[model samples]
Target: MATYSRNRLTQLLPFILSLLLLGLNSGQVQAAPKAELWPLWQPTVATGQSAVPDFKHWENFLSQYVRRYADGLNRVDYASVTPADKAQLKALLEQLSTTDPRGWGPATQKTFWINTYNLAVVSLVLDHYPLDSIRDIRLSFSSLFNGGPWEDKTLSVTGQELSLNDIEHRILRPIWPDRRLHFALNCASVGCPNLATQIYRVETLDQQLDAAEQDFLRNNRAVLWQPGSNTLQLSSIFNWYQVDFAANENQLLDYLQQQGAVSPGILSTPDLKISYDYNWNLNTDS
Candidate 1:
C-alpha cells in the first residue's frame, strides 16, 4: 500500500506544483501597489533662485532614436545608438541629478519628473540591451519574483537616491493623482504608452499629456472591444491602477467612452466579459 501511495504522489506532483504557481500569480496580479506619498520627496520652495533643467539633449536623443512605426507603437533604435549620443544621454542624466526642482512651478516639476522617468527606463534598457523583456534585467533574486530594476535605487535627484517606483508611485502619482500622467510615463514595454518624441515642457505639458492619453486609448493595445462576443479587453495597466482611473467597472467604462476608447454601447452590454492582459516585450526597432 505504501509503495502504491508513493507512486500516486509522484505522478501528481507536476499538477500540484502548477496549481500552486497559478495561485501565486493570481495574487500578484490582484495586489497592485498603492500610491502612498514618501515625505522625503515633498517639495519645498528654495530661497535661492532655481531654473528648470533643460532637456534639449534628451529631446535630441529621442528624435534620433525613437520612431513611430505603422504598428502605432514607438520603438527605440537601441542597437543603432552611436557612442557619442549615448555619452550625451549619460551627461543629461548627470546634469539632472544635481538640479533641484523644488523651487520650480508645478508644471515645470511634473515635466521634469516625467522626462526623468522615461530617460531612466531607456538608460536601464541600454545597459541590458538584447534582453527579451525589462523584467529579464533582474538585479537580485528577489527582483526576479517582484519588480526588476524598478526597486533598485538607480537614480539620484537633488542628492536623494530613488528607484523607478519611488518616482512613479511616491512622487508623481501621489503629488498629481492625474490618470493622464500614466500615458505620459513609458515603461519601455510594448504594453506601455508611447514615449513622446518631444520632451515634455512646462509651456505645453497639459496639451502633451492630453494627446498622450488620447493616443494610447485609440490604440488597440490599450483597449480592444470584441463586438461579436461582447468582450472588453484592456491593458493590465487599467487593472493595476484602476483606483486612479475610476471607482468601479461601470465608471471605468464611462471613462473609456469619454476618452473615445470604446463605443457608448459597451456600457449597456449584458454579461460583458472583461479581461486584462499586457505584453512585456521590449519596444525595440529590430
Candidate 2:
C-alpha cells in the first residue's frame, strides 16, 4: 500500500506542473483592451477548437479605417472615403447585432454588447472627427448619453436598439458579477484604459480585465500625480464619471488611495488642485 501511494504521488507531481504552465500561459493577453469602441463584434471566444480568432479580422479592419480617419485629420487631400466604407461597416454592425452564437451563452451576449457599444462610439467619432470627444457626438433624442431612453440609439447590438451608456451602466456592469470590468469601457479619453487590440471573451474576461486595471493603475502616463500632493492630476475618467465611483466611496481621492500604492500613506490634498488630462487623438499603432 505504501509503495502504491508513493507511485501515485509521483505521477501527480508532473500533472500539477503541467497545469501550472497551462494556467500561466492561458488567457494572458499582452495587447490593448476591449472597450465600448467596437459596436458590433462578438468577443473572441475559445470555441474549444484549435482555430480561434485572436482578433485578427477586426484589428486589420481598424488599422485600415483608423489610418484613413487620421489622414482626414492632417490631409484632406487623399482618396475620399466613399459611402461604401460607411455602409459596409454599418452592415457588419448590424450583423453582429443579430448574430446568435450557437453553443454560446448569455455571458457571451453581454460581452458582445459591451464591445458593440465601444465600436459604435469609435465609428461615431470617425464620422465626426476633427472633434474633441465622444460627448461631442449627439445621441438621438432620448438616447442614453443625452438623458434619453436606453434604446433608440443609432448604434445597434444584436439587432436591438441600445445606447452606449445602457450597455455599460445597465447590462454589463450591474448584472454581471465580475468587478474587474472597470477597465474595459472607455469614454474615448487619454486617461481611459488604452483600448485593447483584441476583443474580450466571457471565458477569459476576468483575467483580461484584472490585467487591464492593474496595468493602467501602475502606469503613470494614463494616470499621474501624488495622492499627497496639494494639487492632484488624475485621469479624466474620474472627472467625467465621478458618480459611478462616488456612491461606494465618499470621494474620488479615497478611491485612488484604495487603488494606489504609497510609500508611507496617502494625503488628502485639501483644496487639492485637480487637473484632467486627455488627448482625443486616434489610438492606432501609435
Candidate 3:
C-alpha cells in the first residue's frame, strides 16, 4: 500500500470530502480513502528468482490494522467487505505473491504467508464468482496464467524459487504448524473454510487460526460432533489426507476426537454424518 500519512490524508481530506458528502446526499456508499486505482494487481518484475521478499513494513502496517480495528477472533464483519473491496484484495494478492518475501523478521514471514494464502484464494473467487469450486479456475486454462499448480510456478519465497504449493505445504506448515489453516486457505467453495475478515496478524496468528477452526467446528460447518452417539462427523479433508490426521488414533473419527471435545464412541455408530458437501461457487455475497 502506498504511504499517505495522516497529515497527508488530512490535507487531501477536503478533496475527498465531496465523496463523503455525496454519500450522505445519495444512497451510494463511498469507498475507503485509501482505495486502489486498479482493481487488479499491477505486476512487478523485480521478483528475482534468487531473492525473497522483505515483509517488515508490511507486517507493521497490517499489525496496526489488527490491533486498532479488527474485532474478536479475527472476524471482520462480512457485510462490510463489498465486491469492490475483494477486487482490491485480488490485486494485493498478486503483488504479495510475485514479490520476494525475504529479509523480513520471522513473525512477518509467518503472517505474510498466511495472508497471501487467504488473499490468493479470495482473488480467485472474485474473478470467477458463481463457480461451483476453486477447480473452476483451472490451472491448465488460467485467464491470467497459462499453467496449473502442477506446472513450474517460479516465485520467490523465503529466499527460494519454490512453487506456490511449496510455500503453503512445505515452508509455511513447518513454521506455523496449526490446524486452523483449514479455515484460512479458501478454495472458493463451500467445503473450504470461511475467509476471515481481518488480515492474519503474525502476533496472533495461532490464536486466529484456533478461533477459525472453532468457528467451523462450532457451526458443524465442516465437522459435526455427537455427544450421545460418541461419533464424529467430518469433512472429506480427513478422508483425503488420511496420513495427516491418521496417526495414533488411526481413523477420521479418532482425529476428530483428538481435535474435538467429544469422546471416542461415535466411530462405532452408524448415525454419524460424513457428508463433505463443498460448494465451488464464487464467494461474492450476491
Candidate 4:
C-alpha cells in the first residue's frame, strides 16, 4: 500500500508543478510590480502661463483624415496616413505630453483633454489598422485582466504614464462634468459619438459641444423612438454614465430633449419605457 501511494504521488507531482508554472507565466501568480495608479485630477492651469495651446496641426490632421458617412458615423481614413502625417501626429502628441496644462482655463483644458483622448484613440487604431473593431485590440496579458486598448499606458503626460481610460474617466468626466463631453470624445465605435471633422478649440468649445449633442441626438442610431411599443430608446452611454445625467431618468430625458435628441412628441409621454443599447462595431465608412 505504501509503495502504491508513493507512485501515485510521483505521478500527480509533475501535473501540479506544471499548473503552478502556467499560473506564474500567465501573470495570475507571482504578481509583477504594480503599475502607477491614475490620478483623480490631471494637472490643470497654473498661474502666469498661456491660456490655450495652439491646435492648428491637430485641426489639419482631423480635417484631412476624418470623414462623415451618410449614416452619420464619422470614419477616419487611417489607412491613407502617410509618413509625414504620422510624423506630424507624433510631434503633436509629444508637445502635448511635455506641456503643462496648469495655466489653461476650463474651456481650454476641456478642449485639450478631448483632443488628447480622441487623438490617442486614433493613434492606437492607426497602429493596428485594418481591424474590424476597436474591440479587437486587447492590451491585457491574461483573460482575468482583460481590457481594451484603452488600458495601455500609451502616453506620458505631465510625467505620469496615462491611458485612454485615465484621459476619459479620471480627467475629462471629472474635470468638465458636462454630459455633452460624451459626444465629443469618440470611442471609434459605432455606438459612440461621431468624431468631429475638426479639432475642438477653446474659443468654439461651447458651440462644438452643442453641435455634437444636437447631431448625435438627431441621429436615429442614437435616439430611436419605437413606435410599436411607444418606447424611447437611448444610447448605452446614458446608462453607463447615468450619474452624469443628474442621477435620474427624467433628467436624462430632459437633457436629451434639451439637446434635441428626441422630438417633443416622443418626450411628452410621462412614464415612458426607456432602454439603453450600444453597438461595438468599428465606425467604418460603408
Top lDDT hit: 1
List pairs with backbone clashes in candidate 4: 44-102, 45-102, 45-103, 46-102, 46-103
Error of 2 at 255 (Å): 5.3
Better TM-score candidate (1, 4): 1
By TM-score, is 1 or 3 better?
A: 1
Candidate 2's C-alpha runs over 4 A off are 1-56, 62-88, 100-103, 139-152, 177-179, 220-222, 226-229, 239-264, 268-286
**Candidate 1 global lDDT:** 0.85
lDDT of each: 0.85, 0.52, 0.49, 0.74
Give candidate 4 misplaced runs (Cα > 4 Å): 1-45, 48-53, 142-147, 267-272
Candidate No. with top TM-score: 1
Write the residue-wise lDDT of candidate 3 on 182-223 in tens digits.
566654445556666566776787788787776666555466
For residues 1-286, what per-residue lDDT tens digits would candidate 4 score against the true structure? 9999999999999898667544533331122122233353555445636435576777888898889888888877877888788777777777777766756666767778898888888877777778877766766643224325666788866667888877777777766678788889898888888999898877888999989988888887688999788888878777767677766888878877777777788877766788777776777664
State which candidate, 2 or 4, has the greater TM-score. 4
TM-score of each model, paired residue for residue: 0.88, 0.57, 0.56, 0.78
Winner by lDDT between candidate 3 and candidate 1: 1
Candidate 2 residue 77 Cα shift, in angstroms, is 16
Output the better candidate (2/4) by lDDT: 4
Worst 10 residues of 2 by lDDT: 69-78
Comparing 1 and 2 on TM-score, the stronger one: 1
Q: Please report how far candidate 1 places residue 229 from its true position, in Å.
A: 3.0
Which residue segments of model 1 deviate by more than 4 Å?
1-30, 46-48
Error of 2 at 12 (Å): 81
